[model samples]
Target chain A: MQQIKKDFPIFKRTINGKPLVYLDNASTTQKPIVMLKVLENFYFTSNANIHRGIYTLSEEATDKYEAVRKKAAKFIGARTEEEIIFTKNTTEAINCVRVSWGEKNIKKGDEIVVSSLEHHANLVPWQELAKSKQAALKIIPLTNDYTLDAEAYKKLLSPKTKLVCLTVESNVTGTIVPVKQMTALAHAVGAKVMIDGAQSVGHIPTDVHNLNCDFFAFSAHKMLGPTGVGVLYVKQSLMEEMAPFMYGGEMVESVKATSATYRSGPWKFEAGTPNIAGVIAFGAAIDYLSNIGFKKIMAHEQELLAYAKKMLAKYPQVKIFSPSQKHAGGIISFAISGVHPHDIATIFNNEGIAIRSGLHCAEPLMNYLGVYGTARMSFYIYNTKKDIDTAEKALKKVLKTFKL
Target chain B: MDIYTETILDHYQHPHHTGALNDATVSATEHNPLCGDVIKLDLKIKNNVVEKIGFVGNGCAISQASISLLCDAVEGKKISSLKKLKPKDIYDLLGVTISPGRIKCALLGLSALQKALKLTKN
Candidate 1:
């Protein structure tokens, strides 16, 4: 399928007369026109504080807001609506687990296995949790091809392991992990699994039930939804002891003279006035993505990755750090031998092809790859072959400017 | 032709005064955690006079080149003189118009030097 360029208004703009070609999907995606309209319609028509409203508008807002929970549940293959909790973002969701679930389960001397390829969102909370609880954090290293070494991960699992927190895909390298097989391994050793789907849930088919992961966290913006909204899917069987990530507002079921009791289901964890418009818009985004189908999106991205690889190979100075397309997702992380990645990005900006160049929020991975940072070119449903041609021309400008 | 000019690229490719001082009187390291850019400055001072100054870092071209340029400009100069150096001086030395996003990158080495000079006096 061709990119519906008109569907995104940003594609109509130009930088110095150069048409815009957004190549930063790994960072965040440009919202479609339909998504924008959803946000507007919610504010214009159905704006009200949900779950606490008594009027008709409030009830209508509440219905639209809670309906997204069901959509998100089916989107991720969660067993029921009660299993989904709306969070501010993936980072907050992971932090929620660190405090709500991790504090009660992980004790001193217990081990948590995490891969080195995780973003700071997935890595930092576990590090802090392990530090505060005095637990052990075991790391799984990446192989020669930059994919997580599954063989090495098997060695890290044991009865002493209490949790396995990792990303389903590495945002920096776009390497997809075998989360299903890894979750089964964690389960065999009586360990719970938490999958950071910030980079994978929207790109691939994620079935929390099939994977059997106890917890799954993902952001909405990564999947064509609105920002400031994310999801945390907790298995119903594990919810008996789960505490609210925050405690206030409608979260408290009843107030008493001495003590208070909180509500059951996901409402207990949602402790404030939710992002009503963002959630409703995110629900619309879910329907939009489902309509396109993951199969079409994946196949289109695969084609983009292959074509970009062939074009990059022509330049001897171009050095790619992402694994081959078979293992890699849609991102192409690379550096031109002598030129800095930041320089390449500035040059791309001039060419109107937006790309990201930095540590990409995965500093430990940068340490592993032995580079300061890499320039990344990512693809989504909106990008097309013509954008690749523009990127090729931009690369030529960069090499010429650097005299490489 | 733009920010990545010939002089900037030359310094980035072949940085001057890049290494650690063995008997340095003062040293400081600064990092931009937002993008993981690191710059370390080592100073050798003899009775308030700048005897030797060197740096080491792994960052963007603007940051790395700015440090290399900073080292060359401050060598053999008094530490007190560097205390009054302003951001504009580095901008002029780099010979490029830095955009708002990269202002921090251009000033990373300067900040490290300013801190290192302060520590040397103490």
Candidate 2:
């Protein structure tokens, strides 16, 4: 934990004249020094466009860019590097799948199954696809505890289901959806599966092959990597079947006045000059995580979450949203009685403790919970139990301050 | 806890003119679902002047206290005058420059008051 804290230089700084205790990992994790330095080194040395020139700098840039792809492929346990395609973020990655796969495959009368506990990025693209394709967008309801009922999910799946797009971990509730089981079920129904791994990738160890999802989407920023970079892992066989979403310079093999030939699979998906520095920095982030061991990171987070739950449970004013499931990831969402989440967050901010308060880009889940929003504290390796202790103390003071 | 200024905290802890005003001609409820801040404002107007102003709700100290302060500031004032009250007035009264996000919480009460005034004028 001490070593982990050292990696984040911003953690040493102060906010509002007080020591910073950042708990907004669910929004975006702080980049480690290794990731930051990797970015700096790229700009300082190999500052050139990738895959275009035979110059040494360009060759170096291209190698670094493709190397990150290999790292990202291994990071998510993709079967091959060709399955990975870079995009702006998870939002874009999901959009790529919606445009590339849904545009071609989804027809009128087909269905796309998604869970109620999805971020707007995961939900909106599919809704737009359903709208354009005249397909049915079926949402599997969440149980009272915020878990997706497998029975309800099974009932939602049918031969008419063209795709099942869902999040692996809900950003709002921290509920880990049974993605592997759901993927298997979707496959059985002959529907493609796309798991939104935006909130899951660095939070937990993910194996795409083991899960057997047709595609997985996630952002680098959520995993202590640079922003403006994300990965969309398409199954090799499925990649061959899907059409390209975008067309332009980097992706095309040849262009004529009337027609154009495009590159295959991942290259075809990447249409323009990508975020080279961000992708390179992402490789550094992967290395940092690999060094720490994802298992150790997961264990640390689980311990923190357990401790946080136990500490917060003492406050009767506090209402926890996520179920007390062992499989739930390291996010805690709760509402303090008599105090609005914004108020709680405001008070915490004054104390130099950052937390996310609102629907967390998951309005459907917020509606299902019957709460307007919640104050969410998400844990990463850099976070300590002491930080949660400070948050708890601050929360108690906030409750008393509000006369709750 | 210091998110609310000392003045605002005082008002929150001992809210003035809080609770429903019976026989009130105007009432409105405003909510910031993002924060779970709910304010139920009750106002009585006579001859275009606010005869009484009161509020009841569940919220943070900033929100509740801001409403209490709003009640004190708006009572006996013209409903038309209250309609022009901006969030900055509340922030100035609190004597703190709130973060952009918390400005909404600080202003939730004023927004409710404005809504009530709008209904009363109608």
Candidate 3:
């Protein structure tokens, strides 16, 4: 873990005269030196328009860029590289599915099921799709314990259910959903499933085949890769059936005056010049994570989450919104009894501890939980027990500063 | 810590004029949707002048203290004059430097006050 910490140079930074204790992994993880180097090196040597130029540098750039699709496919256990589509981020990837598949499949009176735990990225797009198509948008409510109510979800499915969108892990509550079982349930009702992997892919083992989801969307920035690059894994058959999300240069096969033929596979969905350096660096990030392996990553995160939970339990004023340890992930969302989340986050920031305090882009979940927002602390491979200890001291300072 | 000084903490801990005005002429509420900090202001006006000012709200120290100080600054002042108050005035009243991120928290009270002033009849 110390070696992993060293891989991220941001740890060397001092905030407010104190060592940084960053716990905002769910928002975005710090980039590692290896991934950063790959990003810089690509621009240095292989800066060229891919798939357009016939020169050697362009060919080399195209090869390196395309190779990441294969790496990403293997990283997530997809069937083939053709199943992966590069987009801006998780939101764009989900929008790609909505525009390409959802807009076509969902009809009037059709049902689109979403869980209570979904981030706005997954929820809003489906809401708009359902609204535009005059379809029914049903939600699977959360239980008293903050986990999605499985019984309610099963009852929500019907013959008209066209799609079920759920997150692999909640960015707000950090509840690791049983997506595989839920996917199977959606499949039983003849509905395709799209798993939002923004929070899960980086922290846990994610296999599209094992989960059996039709689509999976995640951001590179949240997984130790650079920003502006994300992956959308579409099942092979579904990818063939779906339309191209955007159409322009590189996606077209032949341009007639009136109509143009489109390229096959993921390239069709990627319309213009993609994030070449970010994608190539994302490949290096995949390699970096693969070298460390998920077993170690998950263990370290779970340990940190458990220790933080233990530390938070000592504060009676603090209320935990995440599920119990068995179902929780590497994130913890909580609020003090009298202190607002913003105040808590400010005090934490003063102490050089970075934790997110807001609705976390999950306002619907916050509304359901009956809180304006909760302060969140998310762990990753680089986080240590010492970081959690510093966060605890900051938490105590918040209580003191508020005179609670 | 710099933003939360002794004066701000005093106002936060012992807020002034924090009750709903039953005989109010106008009232308005403003909130920072992201932070969930809300400020509701009630005012009683006489001859285009503010006779009394009160408020009730829930939020962080900065927001609550800002509104507390705002109540004291606006009471007995002319409604037309109160509308001229700027965000800088609120920062000056707080007597602390408000960062860009906390600007909304610091100005929420002023926004509500101005909104109430707009609702006041001439």
Winner by lDDT: 3
| Candidate 3 or 1, higher DockQ | 3
Question: What's chain A's TM-score in each predicted model?
Answer: 0.98, 0.98, 0.99
Q: List model 1 lDDT by residue over A236-259, tens digit each.
A: 988769877897787899988888
Docking class of 2: acceptable
**Chain B TM-score of all predictions, in order?**
0.95, 0.91, 0.96
Quote fnat for model 3.
Answer: 0.67
Which order, best to worst by DockQ? 3, 1, 2
Cα RMSD to the true fold for all candidates: 1.4, 3.3, 1.5
lDDT string, candidate 3, B1-40, tens digits? 3777888888988999998999998999999987877778
Q: Which ten residues in a row have the lowest lDDT in candidate 3 chain A?
A: A395-404
At residue A297, give the lDDT of candidate 3.
Answer: 89
Reference-based TM-score, model 1: 0.97
Segments in model 2 whose C-alpha atoms lie over 4 Å from true places: B5-86, B108-122
Residue A45 displacement in candidate 2 (angstroms): 0.7
Give native contacts recovered, as a fraction, per prediction: 0.54, 0.62, 0.67
How high is the lDDT of residue A264 in model 2?
94
Best by DockQ: 3
